[model samples]
Target chain A: MPAAEGTAPLAVILDQAGLDGLLTAIRAKGWRTIGPRVADDAVIYDEIETVADLPMGVGDEQKGGYYRLKARGDQALFGYTSGAQGWKRVLYPPRQKLFSAKRTASGFTIDPMAQPDAPLALIGVRACEMAAINVQAKVFGDKDFADPGYQGRLKGALIVAVECTRAGDTCFCDSMGTGPEVGTGYDIKLVEMVGKAGVTYVATAATDKGAKLLKAAKGKPAAEADLAAAAKAVKAAAKQSRKMETATSAKLKDVPEHARWDQVAARCMTCGNCTMVCPTCFCTTVEDVTDLKGDHAERWRKWDSCFTVDFSYIHGGAIRTEVRSRYRQWITHKLSTWHDQFGQAGCVGCGRCITWCPVGIDITEEVAAIHDSTKGRK
Target chain B: MAERKRPKLAVWKFSSCDGCQLSLLDCEDELLALTEEVRISYFLEATRKIEKGPYDVSLVEGSITTPHDVKAIREVRRQSKALITIGACATAGGIQALRNFKSVKEFIRCVYAHPEYIDTLTTSTAISDHVSVDFELRGCPISKHQLLEVLNAYLNGRKPNVPRHSECIECKANGIVCRMVAAGTPCLGPVTQAGCGSLCTGKDRGCFGCFGPMETPNTAALAAHLKELGCSGRDVQRLFRSYNANAEAFRKESETHG
Candidate 1:
């Protein structure tokens, strides 16, 4: 439950020591707390048991087709940009068994598999990732035939968002109007500031649950100076971000006809890496598995990508036969057609597609190329 | 009238490392259950019991390298209702296709003491190149999961839902960091098919394109990107000429660099 929309939001200040209590509060409510941890030279989201598991004093450098972990002198957890993994994996798993069937004397008896339905409390979620999750909600939470698996995990979930204090080389969430600041869609919004005094966190409660947790944690009301510092950190992040112009997204419909796709196709492996790393990508293919006895069979739904040739397969042949066409479909759908289907852009400007692409093809640059070529062609 | 009979299945091998056939035995948990549904009529690797076919499904492993193998494969196709080729060796000539570039006589002389005793074709080719194939599973060693899916699909009389995408998709779905981006390593995952479960990437190495090129792969684009990553023209050529070198997409890409 959240306070009335017009009411003033409650704010509190917590030092490094108070972070432990915040984790305790979330855990005390019987919620699985997930946060960032250092693994594979990048920040990965996983179950966090204690503060020590967090990637403290760690910063990451991310560019188009580049990522490296850098150690910062000051201990600052949640200091890096979003990594390869996101909250989507927790909600919509990579692979899930839909149901299993056993051969009966007559035909077959099908048994639906039970989905993992534990309540989750996500900590240190970036604003861009929040937008991705929100976008995915529309894809999976459709009224006609919503995905029960995603819905089950989403129910009673808590989001503890963290505003960005720094931006990566590929980041453009500011231009996407999705990040660098946390305005909504969160239970508690935390802004961490590392200063000469010490590392401090400014937290604002947007919901009753968040407010109760903030009150229970050992913390004082945030001073005006502390609030100013938090705002400055976020402002700096926004200023540093290498942004993609959102206006280009409007003209993305003409991208398929552009010659740039062929040029991109030459350098593109059609690897589907970008689609896989994209938090909002929700395409999937079903697989049927049977035991040698043929008595037992199971249907599994695994995460799928549009970059595959089979992804567009029709009765006769593939619809999108060229690698260039597949790339065009992917980028266009993310930027323009998604608006037609979901009423919101598919991309959140988190730049995962740029960072994780095997060849370092930047989506922002592709959009710019399309915009430049399609100019006045209408 | 004959009693309700189980479908007879046969496994055949040609010129390969026997790794793909091992993938069948690797399904240890399902082996017993599988035998109950389909009779293992002619798998020489597993059992001595050989039942002559009119096999319901025939699983072929390895490429057609020798002149004798060419005749053997046609007869096998005649006996099989559905013929499926498994692994790079069967689907795209395997690493042996490297001979397609060089002289077979020179290779035989270099490797064997008696070149006169050796009998091999100048080129190693896919089974489909010689005979009609119902399905082809791609991989250096076809995934066990995929093999099972293919069998299940054929048994149900439906198309197998095998993904024809690059390894980049699997790496991302599994939450793996791109080795090329993070380490400046050149990877062929962009053009290689998805089936190997991102094996090399999981081990912190770039994909070596063991599964060959995905459908309509943009090899020229990937080659140019590889060049930018400091991979020389020869390096790019060698990369494409590995396991599935004779594959149409990879063969064309490698030839461009060569």
Candidate 2:
């Protein structure tokens, strides 16, 4: 099961001890590595220095509007799916000050805040989030008005994605064709499988840089059985995952006039939580601020939501005034019009919207309702 | 005219706690620079120097719980070119509006040594109830960024960009896991206005509706959902009766459940 003489190693089997070396290798490359950690009763993405810092032996309970971290006995890392925090915050910060101005003797002098330039190595990224990041890259990296900050962050980072061995209750990435397996958009992809022997990570280098790091980390060249196990693990995860109606994404645009919009709107709070948790949701509002003396002023950009009445405001009033209309706008924009605008679906089906929703409003359920109610009518 | 003078900005307080006014002061990073932009004519929380009438923009906090407050707000509104209400107390009737649901005389008798000494209105009403307001920044204590936005908008002759969406939007944007679904906790986030940066939800708890109800909130649906989540009618009632209990939307919702 060794690699052919001239062929490069496609996969490597890393024992439990090699995780430390992997962390060391990432840090040795002068990258600030961050991954999932158990904090505040949930798995949160944070800075990790060692393997122990990872949410080892932790599994998450996720449902529509619910989340909790529990011990799963086996000391398996990357067992949990998406948490409250995503890589988007690390890439495009929640609150970013664009520029600061000062009152000079002549006039005001504006100074753009220096963007953080350090290379970040994001560990434990799920496949769904990879798709989310791709969607975000399209939005923020739009040719016309690309966010320099986002571009810089994207350019300076390395993505270390993790294949899901098990999916969360709210996850529908399988149906979305986004996850449970690692395909692309990552430097390295790790699949941790706990076997009868012990925990071993089936690592695949997606880039040359990732390959060098894997070699430096000193994991054994993966056997054929190890590769099979990893693929089997991903398949099992895909089978176990809660799925959405895949056809709904394509049919979403055609059913805007469906009565289900009203029914879903009744339950939709127009809180925009779904958009907020959505990794691809990049709406932002800018605010101008002046100090007490009015001499120095600064403009800041913070996250905004489509659900806000003022988001679609004009001179007379807001366009989407009704809550139902706003909800309709959000769902349509996310599922249907997003393809028209961004050339891709806005949702990655990570289920953050469902898991973070206060009333447990499920996007997949809403879309399914629309699809089902208007199956052949139109 | 010699040179166009700088517009005067004033911050006024009334019946409630000074938290909202303090929010303006909490803009410590921008406070010194803000003074350079507008004259701080009257802000008792930061400075005691009282400026004369006819201020360009007045930021008023608190509710009209006393007859004195009602008259004072009218005078303040009359004197200011643009009067913007800051916080739940100034827009919605604040936490003290629970008094609106009970007998003022009985409450005065119960809390005070002598009911005769107390001179109070039966209801605590927002400034808008008595006088027209240019804008209202809703929150238990308005966000500093939002307060700055309002002041900036007023100064620039534009509308403030503060949102009227519910807390669920903020919670979602923050990527904070939903406590209601995960823990069976009842959250007011769905119907409550956006602000507070999803603080409660980020801290692993349900939103207590500190920002009040969003415009045209469907409380009936939320109430039914809360019931399905094991929140009884009384629990739903109590949830809506939190910070902005007397705010029209929340008040009606609370009454429906009660």
Candidate 3:
């Protein structure tokens, strides 16, 4: 076995070359490395085999209905905040086949889908994203009935969390008490410091798997000065301008008739973009498909959003017919009833819901309206 | 207990580019298999061997622009058990319906040297306007995968497994960047139905509303946002007046603008 993480080193320093070799080391050990890469005009999680694939000297400006990549003018890696996509897709894929059936003599023969193979090592995960993953864990696995695909993929995956050094215009993870610092559930926590010495990461292993990988990278022991700078950077990142109040978690369920929902609904396109981009919003519906000849049939589980009118369909018609009800359902369930169902809030303050919304409906601004109004009523 | 027979299928056309009907033929692999599943009783685009109707399932394409088209569609409906209209023409009156906003008589005078010979309706209309359509498949040229699903569902005696959600969901699911939000392109995805596989958006251009209005789409909200994105009155109006222009929600939203 590998040495214990604590016994290995308190922290290690990884320069550019060390970081490049670290990726090779990760892949050499049978881990398919998935990390942030610039694609589709945004930094999204995709297959990454080299450190060069990382968005170096890059930052993003994000706001409600806005995301733009800009040159950071520095070699600092991990300088930007989280993209619209998160690590949720890694664990729970958008579409997965449940099983398939072929026509048999009597009726049909069902064949279950094969379980996932080739374990993944997620790189450059943010603190807010980690919280979202934890929230999903509670939602998917904590119950008596667990999502097999999600549980299987999550159990085998390795997490490489990155501390935020920069906050976007829409980022409010600090307000949610989940971000700007690596809290827990990470194998290796890396903090990047770009200076005259060059881009060096203060990498700390949190598990034996991380330690073994860190040893393979062969990075130098971290200096006290560099460690202090990394800590200061994280603290500065925590001092974000945007903040959201968690007071809605206790009150939003009771006040469904809140007029703010109608106001938000007017601007809300009900496009379902917010829910799709949200890291913790895990809802899927099954699609049963058959070949043209009807000889073969397959069932696939696909991503579903509550914003769709048919989502609440019954025998008679749809329950949430009006736009107001759908928006109300989303916000209320995300903030309040999700706590009732999963023992935690659905949102992780990642601001994806805000950034990706067509009309720029900030969840924090919506919550604040309710939080302030409800608090004033008493 | 009685023996079962294969579902007799038919294909009919009216005023269209025949692209939607061609989508069925584009299913090269599935077409041969489709032939085994249903009798091709009336697809002239494929074969000259004409088979009479009273078809179990009829796939109708194009709009009812002329009086002859109106008469022929009712005859097709009378002869078929389940009538499913395919593409924008048969479902939402196609690009030809742009004349619905203007005078066809004046257009004939402007273009046709012999204006008297041109016999057409003043306004184009969908097949459902005249008769009760069993189902309507909306698209400029309907997706073959979706077409197969519709046929497969109809065969199995189940509701078609098509989603009534917006095109925004399709774009997001496919991991295509939002052209409207990210690039300031005036896409109709938020208000348009989920189909066409985000073709325009995937190409980094805005959706032209080829798939028509989705279920309970907020066109007013999307239109207002489009205006905020620097679209003028005409730009917003023209954005909805594409392949699925004459679709109800789109037509109403277009009327509010230029």
Candidate 4:
């Protein structure tokens, strides 16, 4: 339906063809589209071209130490709860070459790595992931230590967030106050409601750029009925089965020596998978590579994890020698001290850490175990 | 150009496949330039030219399996300024180290027509077990990049920039999916050293751990998870007892299983 009189529509209803048109419009704005795709038996985020590239009929199951992709029976584009990998792989990048140095007769000649030519257009982003992006933005783009590569990628990027209508077993974003519904920071907000309309999507423009792009899609103005249905769907998602006590975020640092840490550390592989999959874990280390002939040298910045023994390295040896201390540092900093440091808890509750861990050590369980044991004790 | 005398490099082999030694030759493009950086004095694989003792850097490959190998390693230690062991065999004990669990006498009787003709040690041991090693490069065949780094670091009088962390770090750094986590495959990446660029996992296979145990590896923790991931006790044991079988952490963990 068209908008009433001369007023522009606040929301639009996008069908199959309209979705494709939206992707085209995003491309027209000179942004490379990236979204979830069914690869390696998991819905991992990669460069996507058409609507066919999306995980349309796929559903994902995630638990502590477990993640599996299954057929959703019906064609629901946003059926999956969370992604195997987060957005950091694109924004901050996994491994980035900082600079390359070559030995000249006069002095050393150094060249910095080039910036990306085109900006990114992230499609099908979840609400929790939006929060994760914001958290990482703060981490990388802070005044004292601004990462140009990260800030540049984020600054020129367009975000299309999809409000989740289903909560996975590992999801606890409702309690974290970050998800199930799109909060601030999204450019375009889409609520995927698979109802009587059959795989319907309510597209609401969150920014002026989003409004101009939505108009290009030529989708119908969203009726009042479609808007209400979308609201009901998000309300269902808000019924989070797995709840992490927000209060636990404040006291996690207090119980550093808690017995629960040893128990959790027993199962923790310390493989650093948790930090790898976490969208907010932004620690990095640099390595210098030289041609064996020693003529040229290149330095690379790689994502480092707190779980590794080398993460706490000094002159003599690593401080966190034991897995227990490393585990304590990761969880403590993620839930508690992060709030003190960044004014927001590090965990966005996407639960990628829980799903991608080889041994399935649940972070929420560890936090709750300590939270319960330390209850009412001043 | 300043007339700086090049350092002497000696490549020695012991009792195993020449795969690790081949890794040096495998630096096909860099090999020629490497010769310019150092004098190819004592490499039997590339050059039959054997130079005198007191070499600048010695790259020793293979395990010390026999009495002759044990004595030779000590002599190599005395001659070389820096002795860097290469591959699983020299650093741990190669696949041949599997014999460390069994009797060498029985094996000789099974393989050889005359058991009396064979003169072999009961166990295959690392170069470090015999003499002082400045460094040890891990892998069934060392990573070509790491080999160059070691050569570059020691030759330039600085510590090698080889990371002693788990393979998981490398896998994540390269955006390789966790085969063990995503597909429920049994992997040794959590316990194995960071090298080989997470080669196996990048190919959608679990890490067989060509690189030996990482520094401060908790093998027992990995073993438990491997078992939970549908690896049987013997399966878990055999997994740890593969290329780097006789490495201390892998050896101890394997012994705990069947």
Candidate 5:
């Protein structure tokens, strides 16, 4: 493949040592490195010391609503689907302190809390995960009311995205247009290549920050053949994905009030696991914790979900008291109404909601039902 | 001496999970600023601060289930200038309204350790069912952005720009490919109201109707499609009788299947 014109070509083919060198270079820069690691029955994102900590030679078995880890025949370093965790855990965080207050002789003196750390490097991020991050950035950073905490944490984080060589059955990034290939908004992108000699990686710098990092690593410049191999890998991943094709935006707006929502609601436990695991879900609730001394009070912000009943309370009563209404609110907001607010789809097509949903309610099937019925409306 | 007037804002709770009230406090940065704009009169969730009403604006959460609640709501109505119901529990009777189908006593016995202690009414009803609601914000937990929009609108004396369209409109505007058409997946985006912005559909999942019915929802047609996709009649009935079971349209649809 020919390089795009006018863009400086910064590419390298790294052997196995290149992986360790990359992690070493990131750590040497005083930036914390977080990636996928094995933990209790599933792969979770955590801090890493070296390349050895990464999930090597492992692929995930994912279905319509199920996900599991399995062994890969080849000892490949980047051969897995997305895990239950996303970068949101580190960037947004599950819980954080907002402010602390104390009563003084004159009045109350409230001290605001500082945001989380900066300059964290996220390695092995997928295309879908990157899309999720962008969606969250809009929610927490771009709007009229920006979340200071999220803004502080995301300021200088470096993203090292990896292109998927294969997709799981549950994968639908292709349908969402988020990915099998790394798109814009990454610092560095990596594509792993397997051959008779050994496992190697073709790395490319997406930004000036990425180019600066690549200058430290010693590797051969990528040949035209290498870039072609990377493109082929991305295409294969896309092909492997199970396609879902409804005019998602149009159907969501057109379908009339339907009983189909009741079908999924009947099995939905409303446990809120889906929202908890979602990468872009930023809704939260606050709690006040008063110190035993009674002079100081602290407030905390924690993640909240629309699936919970208390989320919709009113003076006379709850607006959505039934399971169907709650389910309807969540689905519509994600697929249809999110556009009006954000000018983009709220979902990034990661399929985390499907695999993590305890009852395995599939979103693709629900949209198809609506499309078939609402075609006339369109 | 001249007196400073604070906008009296009352936070009232009925039958809910107490999540929407949490959204107000969830405005950690804005919460302090908000207090300066309005008086924290009757929020039981945040503080023990209780102030007498004739409130400027009242934010009520949860549903009315018992006979006592019916009378309490009337007093709330009388005391507030503008009333807004937040979340699914307040706007649609919430998931607890599942009891709208079966005997309330049986539901109580199924979950409670001491059913006798459960002094509840047979049906869990929404705020609008009993009294006039100025505005209704939809969501199991109303979107904080939408909540702020409602507050800002009322404070400015203007109509809130809440959408009355379906979820399908949001999905199209976002440019997300229809998951159901491409993958044979069933979705509720067509009939459901827009608020969630097609979050589930973008994630490759179907709409579950957490926002409630759209303005002119055609649930029967969507139900027929679900039947074609292998759902049973019981499935159709159960679908409508969910979070908004007590809602007029949803309740009527479920009755048709039943």
Candidate 6:
């Protein structure tokens, strides 16, 4: 046990012993702890109940069109970056049974799905992921059309945000001003310093829930040295990130119609991988599923990408049939038009689109190309 | 002596992806309530139940691309008291309008093995060209809220409070830092109408003009800006000839550049 904070906050060092102890403690709290664990060949976000479940001494290597897990020199439980799956799967499940209906003599009786009763403790959340959650909150929790399912899942959930110490080649959260260090929108933020001095975890509470959690944990008070080390870690991560300049909350009207989109469209595949991986992309399509008996029908809404030809199809035919138009729609809406609708730039610069894209399409490169092309004309 | 009546509502399809109609169904919570307010007399996408018209309101989707479509819309016009065209297809010819520049024959041959089976008009034109449209709800897929607003306005006997302003005004109100100035990203928000809630820009991307051109859009100035941004003449042409390629403002702009 390390020196305690004013009270006994959790004092485990997150080493082999601490990892086991922390997992045991979390389970003892009667809460489900979700963290990064190895599944198949890649590290995926999943449920973890033991130290063995953690991806120790592993870090993700990500770049434009590349993502892989690599070995680290030291064993650190929360050393890895984010993976293909996000905490969103836990909160806003991809496929949800909204409401089931059964046919009656007069009409149908509809039954909405029951809300999640169990509370969740998300461990190893990155700052960018936290921002993504914040964005979803506005759409699902803060609005008049509040998603009941999202509300129920997020109501009492605890978020343990781990400040990113390593920036992937595709990472550009700094450009979107969402990360490098854990900003707002987390319960507890932790910065890990791994070196010859073993590993020191500097933790701070961002919300009352986090404060309460810290109070429950038996840990030492974080000193000024610890804070400085955390700051240094954030600075290094910020420096490591590839620069991507973006306009925050910029409107579409400011941009003049130019040839830049066509240039980007030249290479765009219209596969919609960018939108699928995008944390903020919220376009959806409704599907009507009728029972085989044809007595009752159910309507389901699923995520839809603007890249699909059918997405823009009108009565006569599909609008934006060409790859160029689809790419143009996707990028412009994200950077420019989204400001008009949501009062913010759609991109948080997670660089997931850049990394996940099969053809390695880089948004930063496209923007630069457009900027360079028009350099003299303006 | 019996109280006669709910307002009759008809949903007609032309040449669209059925996304706009799906927008109506997406209003899961509101759909049952909406039915109580107005009788859904002829929505094939929702129910096979069809009633003879002189429909109180007819919501039309898609564009007039074939001779049959042209005749069918005329019959719909005769049967409806109010006609509202939803989505880019009905209001501005949508993405299919891309073929307006190229030869329709060549396009058919390139895309389909059985080109002869495809009986399509040379150009996809908006419903407004053939028949009078009471109002036009614009978008690649019409915003559900806007769709509700239009329906409510019609029901309440009020003018729909749809903004005619460009996406720029919305961006400023939303406090979005301009993508063009900050990131040097090429965008079409300036000329595009306000709707879809600045969605593309909010994601740190440029606008693709899915909502179509706003009233009195300065397409020439926008084109000039695009030219300044190093967009080629062909690029400028392609930009105007997108979702709303057949819309007059965008069409003229594309022609000017081409």
Off by over 4 Å in 4: A1-9, B1-3
Q: Compared with the true structure, what per-residue lDDT tens digits does model 4 show for residues A1-378?
A: 233457754699998778889999999879999998888888888899888899988998888778888899887887998877889999888888889998888879897667676999999889889999999999887759898889999999999999898899899898888987877777788888776557867998867788889989998999898898888888888776677776975678877778887887787878888999898999998878777656788888988888877789899988998889998999889989998999989998888888788778888777777778878888
Q: Considering summed lDDT, which 10 consecutive residues are worst modelled in model 5 chain A?
A: A287-296
Clashing pairs in 1: A266-B221, A267-B221, A269-B190, A292-B33, A292-B34, A293-B33
TM-score of 1: 0.94
- Flag the better candidate by DockQ, 1 or 2: 1
RMSD of 5: 11.5
Instruction: Highest TM-score: give the candidate number.
Output: 3
Sort candidate 1 into its docking category. medium
**Over the stretch B1-258, how does candidate 5's per-residue lDDT look in tens digits?**
122366799999999989889988898766775676578889988889798988988999999998889999999999999899998889999988887888988777889998877788898889999999999998877777678767766654555656655665455434344444334466666567777867788788877777888765667666766676567888878777777777777888888885
Stronger candidate by lDDT (1 vs 2): 1
Query: Whose DockQ is higher: candidate 3's or candidate 5's?
Result: 3
Give DockQ for candidates 1 onward, in order. Answer: 0.55, 0.50, 0.67, 0.63, 0.03, 0.02
lDDT of 2 at B6: 77
* TM-score (all chains, Cα) for each model: 0.94, 0.90, 0.97, 0.96, 0.60, 0.57
lDDT of 6 by residue, A1-378 (tens): 122456543322333454355456666777798888875445667788887888888877777656667788787777766666567667765455666777777878886666665788888888788878877777776656888777777776877788888787878788878877776667767777787967667767666556656655646676667677778887877864565546322433344465766665655545455776677777666644543233455666555677655678699988787667777788878888866666666777778788755446788777766655555563
Interface RMSD, in order shown? 2.9, 3.6, 2.0, 1.8, 14.3, 16.1
Q: What lDDT is obtained when candidate 4 is compared to the true structure? A: 0.86
Which runs in model 2 stand beyond 4 Å of their true positions?
A1-6, A101-115, A142-145, A293-295, B1-13, B19-52, B109-118, B142-161, B171-177, B197-205
Query: Candidate 2, overall lDDT?
Result: 0.81
**lDDT of the structure predicted as candidate 1:** 0.84
TM-score of chain A of 3: 0.96
> Model 5, A1-378: lDDT tens per residue?
113569766898888788788778878987899888765445677888887888777777766545667888776877888876678888877667888998787878998665546468998899999888888888887779997767766767888888998887777888878887776668888998877788999999877767768767777899999999888877888864455553654346544368787777666645455676678877776756553233566777766667655567577766876767777787788877778889777777787777765446666667777666666673
The Cα error of candidate 1 at residue B108, in Å, is 2.1
